[model samples]
Target chain A: MDIIVCVKQVPDTTDVKIDPKTGTLIREGVPSIVNPDDKHAIEEALRLKEKHGGKVTVLSMGPPQAGDALREASAMGADDMILLCDRAFAGADTWATSYTLGEAAKKIGYDLIICGREAIDGDTAQIGPQMAEHLELPQITYVRKVDVDNGKIICERALEDGYERVEANLPALLTVISDVNKPRYPSVRGIVEAYQEKEITTWTAADIQADEKCIGLDGSPTSVKKSFAPEPKGEGEILEGTTNEVCKQLVAKLMDKNVVR
Target chain B: MEFALNKEQEMIRKTAREFAENEIGPIAAEIDETTEFPKDTVKKLGELGFMGMTVPKEYGGAGMDDVSYAIAVEEISRVCASHGVTMSVNNSLVCWPLQKYGTEEQKQKYLIPLANGEKLGCFGLTEPNAGTDAGSQTTVARKEGDKYIINGSKVFITNASQSQTAIIFAMTDKSKGTRGISTFVVDTDTPGFSIGTIEQKMGIRGSVQAELVFENMEIPQENLLGKEGRGFGLAMATLDGGRIGIASQALGIAQAAYEESVKYAKEREQFGKPIAKFQAIQWFIADMATEIDAARLMVYKAAFDKWQGKPYTVSAAMAKFFASDIAMNATRNAIQIHGGYGYTKEYPVERFYRDAKITEIYEGTTEVQKMVIAGNLLK
Candidate 1:
């Protein structure tokens, strides 16, 4: 089995800042970390590799620096890593980003593909499904449980009310939530080995054979017209006096505003 | 002139960060609150090859570089300081000594099991009467024919109760003071060997700390580590590497605290605006970030030096001192930034604040680190 785990390098949201004038995210000096949910996805891939005995490759599309995420995957027991990085991939919305990643996955040719349910910064919940559409493959999103046997992928999707179980054929995409499995710490030795042995394979848009018109800001359809801080709501007026008086006043206020039927 | 981390180092940082965030972060408070050692998690770490970071692959270790070891320590410490110490003790205190000084038979017997995480190990150096004054240790070892009879007690030993093996320092020749001290690898199952009471600590409570008593504990001559009079030097060398782990641990704790504070500042509202919009809060965030970055650089430099097999004692001391102090300060600022909410245990920053103080005291005290640095400068 060949599994490809999609990862992203995002500014540690904890350190993210907003540009006051442009209302854009200020990324400078913020440390970049692998997306939290993606870690669960990688762990799932690793578990699959261990049980099924196959290669696990990690793929990421971002700036050149995103190679860090790939290398990280390698250290955490991924067999291989590829970074689909280029200036052309910058500022892409979820649709364009998913399309490019899907294309890269197609080029890699994997039996399974996995990704985080959503990136913390975007919170779009669109990338995995959109990638599945682009690749024309079945997708199981918000997957909390996954098991592979008899050439079939069985998963439980977390829904609002409860969960839905689905089984798919080979060559599928899974968007994992953080509750899937606990990711393992890199051993002292694994860290050293990763430090000494792993190299991230970097690919540009040309390398992935991506269409120029389908990437970056130019390829993205949605653009923010304006971004500003949320407006504050007014504080509630306190009703003072005896409990009965306060209750009466509150009722009268509600009646005056026609809040009570 | 390449200042950037190579692919492997980069991967180590990434993997550790991910693991810390996904596995260790959520449970840190619970474990700290319960004072329970994360045994299952530690076992998982061992299976992942974390137990013997610097030990050679031949010894069942991952045989990674010093940078990786430091990075792992930093990452684990970022989420849980107790786990970080467990890793450090295994890598720096237990495995490193065996690799450097143990004979082939001893290495096979001790290092392999320890590196494989099949067994837990600890170092017995600090005692009730001796800490910074390690040479003043009163544990005595008397040679009797083919065996040595050891009698003494070690206190405040991390991982002591749960550990299967311990490398203990005992004096063979009382007249020679430090030079008379020698190290011996002791199996916990040996007769007359018993673990004393577990210490109630202020922080890193998830790691077990206890007293080890060796009363007429007999061990074969083959258990000796290195030369007869090299225990002091061996202990010092082990601590040099250990300090790097401690520095990284401190860096992790501080980084986590700073990150939590930043997140809270941005989301928390006051006076019709996010608190982050206020200059006072922004300044606190800025200082925390700057300090954490500086501490990270210092720790990395020390780790890099250790990787290169250079003399990193002074650098390690400096890194440990600075990083631990920064951790304390960063957690303090994180609490202040959160205001009343920070005071409550409902938030993680309060736990971080409680956890950070111990970093300055253990591995080496701040005063001790300054002394080490100054002594190196003078030399």
Candidate 2:
């Protein structure tokens, strides 16, 4: 079996200070890391490899520095690592990112494609399905439990209420959540070996045979017209009285808001 | 014991868990197997202010309390021990010293870069002859006019090869023993300063560890840390803080191991039933969970003490010793639960077992920790 995991490098939000004057994210001192959810996707791929004995390849698209995330995936346990980086790929929304990643995945044929439910930066939860649509592959989203056997893939997906058990044939895509498995810590020897090894492969837009029209900002369908922080809720009114009076006031407020029938 | 974490601590814990699970966990084993350093990951950690968790905001650090630092270390280690150590060394050993003893200019120049992750920093004290006995180091420095010429080498220094700056300890007055020692901040770019061979380590290999050789290395007088002859105290103080970080790392490793074991036991079948249904397997999980909880409490207590500006040396030592021991035990049991598969490279528990052993040996050996705790109690 061959598994491909898509990962992304994103600026850690806590470190991302907004420039008030420009209303833009301050990228100067902020460090870009592998998007937290994407890691679950990588782990799921590794898990599939462990159970079915297959090759695990990790693919990511970002700046030249995003190669670090690929190298990191390699260090963890990825059999093959690729960085899909190019200047043309800049300023991409989720649509463009999925398109680029989908094209790259198509180039690297796989029995299964895995990704995190969403990237932390965007939180759109659109990339997995978009990539699936682009690749024209069946997709399983919000996977909590996965079982691979005899070329058949079974997954339990978290839904609004409980969970949904789904089955798909080989060559499908899976977007995972954190509860799937706890990731292993890199050992000292793993660190040393990852440092010494040169397994990360870099690819540009031309390398993946992607059309110029469907590659970056031009290819993207969605664009953020404007971004703003959520408005703060009004302060609560204080009711100073005996316990019964306070309870009555709270009940009245709840009724006024239709929270209590 | 209350299992509930406060809002802020819980938020930090959740964020760290999500980051570690998503970012570091998948690649941790590969980095360990190949000994690769995740430079980008380190930079990301710096942006999160993890590299300077305890340093004040003015110094380009996170300005977080010590408990938050411990939480961060535990969460990171839970996914990748190498990154955990790298984070620990940066936040506690390198960045902490500068924040505490550095002059305003020193803070602006060295601490800023180190804290921001633009530059990596290392702490140097151990020599070939000095591991546990760091005060017996042979590295020396001689004052000449406006500069101090340093000679000799430091061994087994974490982040030495990659660090832009190193807070190094050297003896200035040989006759005064520990009192003669002084600390200096040396730039790795100095003509006479060079990194030696990287050591082939058993675990935590993602972090750079090598010998730092200083041959007639010239440092400006302003680079001297604190007052002359205060190096011993400074080093001790630094280690006190470092112990908590190591303890947190141990807690993370233990948690990872225990969690893996639990999952495996529930899934793997033997004797017509999942091993988790067996008494023996159930007992092991119970022990692992109990010990991990205890270790977490100890580590958090030490971090809390430090955050409160109280003396935490004894608590830190105890935490380090106990947590590291628990890590080793948890990893061993996790492998045992996997049976034969656990011993192979195919299983991560074996690697966790191997990696967990070093936590007891470094950052003040478990034996040394006992001595420290006992000695402090006696005093």
Candidate 3:
């Protein structure tokens, strides 16, 4: 089995600050880290590779700096790291990103595909299902538990209150949640090997034979008109009077506002 | 001369910091209060290839450079000095010597398990009478046909009770003084070997320190490390590397203290303003930050020298003394900056203060470090 995991490098949101005057993110000095949920995806892929003997390959699409993210996944025991880096892939929305990744997946061939439920920066949660549709493979999103045997993948997709069990055939895709598994720290040897011994394969738009019309900003349809931090909520009013009296007053106010019958 | 860490070292620092903050930080206080050994976390560290960072991979170790090892020790110590010393003793004191001097058979038998973290090891050199004057060792080993009879007691031995293997020094020829000493690897389970008294300590309590007594302990001749009468040189050489680790540990302690002081000064209020608004507190923070950075550079220089196969005895000594001094001073100021809360266990500054003291005392004292540095200059 050969598993391909898609990862992204994003600004560490914890340290990111918004400019109060301009309403734009200050990203100059912010450190970049692999998307947190994608770490779970990499960890799950490695676990699957361990239980069933196979190779685990990690792939990403971004600038050259994203190679660091791929190197990190390699340190976590991924067999190979590939970065789809090209200026032509710039300004890709979820659709263009999915198309580019799906094209690469078609070239690499995979027994299974794994992706995070969503990237923290974008929070679109569309890439995995979109890629699945492009590749015409079955996909299970919000997967919390997975079992594989006899070319069939069984997964527990987390729901609002519970989880739903779903099974799919081979050549499937999974978008894992943070609860899927805890990621392991890279061993000292792993870090050394990742940097010294392994080479990250870089593919461009032409290498994956991506469609020129669907590979960059030209293919992306969504556009942001405005972005700003949400307004801070105001303090709530405290009800006055005795318990019964306050309750009656609350009910009357709620009724008057059509908040209650 | 590059000031920045390379990609590999940066990754090591990141991994260690994450591990320290997420896995060890929550339990640090609990372990200190209980004085119980942190066995589970130590085992986890072993799984991460931290127990023997510089040992070769073929020998079941991580095979990392000395700089990477230093960064790891610093990160771990930043959160818990007890774990820091545990890792330091295993890597610098035990596995290092075994890898450098042990014969293939010895490496096969002992080094493999110790390096792999399947077993733990401790160094046994400090004695009741021998502290800084390590040449005053009194333990005796007498040849008895195919075996040697050992008798003596060691004090302040780290990981004494829990260690599966011990690299001990004993007087094989009393007339030769320090030259008579020989190094031997002894299984802690030998018939006459026993843990005597566990010490109650003021700092790094989460790591055990105890007395070891060897009463008529018998061992085969094959356990000897290097050649007879060469133990003193081997021990001294080992301490040179060990000092680098201690220096990194001290740097970590000081860094933690400085960070705490900065955080506390900004939030603590007095006289209608945050204490950070005061010039006096600002000076302390500035001095701490400056010294901590200096100590880190010294440690890195020592580690880099060792990695490059350059002579590093003086550099290591200089780093150890300077870094440890900063650790002590920084932690003291950290407590002062926190006012009454710093002196109490409500904050970790008090714990850092206690842990900082041991860095100056262990491996070699500050005075001994200066002696090594000055002695080289005079010569």
Alpha-carbon error at B282 in model 3, in Å?
0.6
Best by lDDT: 3
Instruction: List, residue by residue over B127-185, the lDDT tens digit for candidate 1.
Output: 88889899998999999998899999999899998899999999999999999999999
Kept native contacts, fraction for each prediction: 0.91, 0.00, 0.84
* Candidate 1 clashing pairs, residues 3+ apart or interchain: A187-B49, A187-B50, A188-B50, A188-B53, A189-B53, A192-B64, A192-B65, A195-B8
DockQ of each: 0.44, 0.02, 0.80
Models 1 onward score TM values of: 0.75, 0.61, 0.96
**What DockQ was computed for model 1?**
0.44
**CAPRI verdict (incorrect, acceptable, medium, high) for model 2:** incorrect
- Extract clashing residue pairs from model 3: none
How would you encode candidate 3's per-residue C-alpha lDDT over B105-220 as one tens digit per residue? 99999988888888889999999999999999999999999888999999999999989999999999999999999999999999999999999999998999999999999989
TM-score of chain A of 2: 0.87
In terms of lDDT, the poorest run of 10 residues in model 2 chain A is A185-194
- Second chain TM-score per prediction? 0.98, 0.98, 0.99
How many clashing pairs per prediction, in order? 8, 31, 0
| A1-261 per-residue lDDT for model 2 (tens digits) | 899999888888977887777677788978767787777777878877887788989899987778767756665678788888898887787878888998888888899999988887778889899899988889999999999877789999999899999999888989999999876433222322344555567788899888888878887777889987555479978998999999999999999999998
lDDT of each: 0.87, 0.85, 0.94
Model 1 CAPRI quality: acceptable
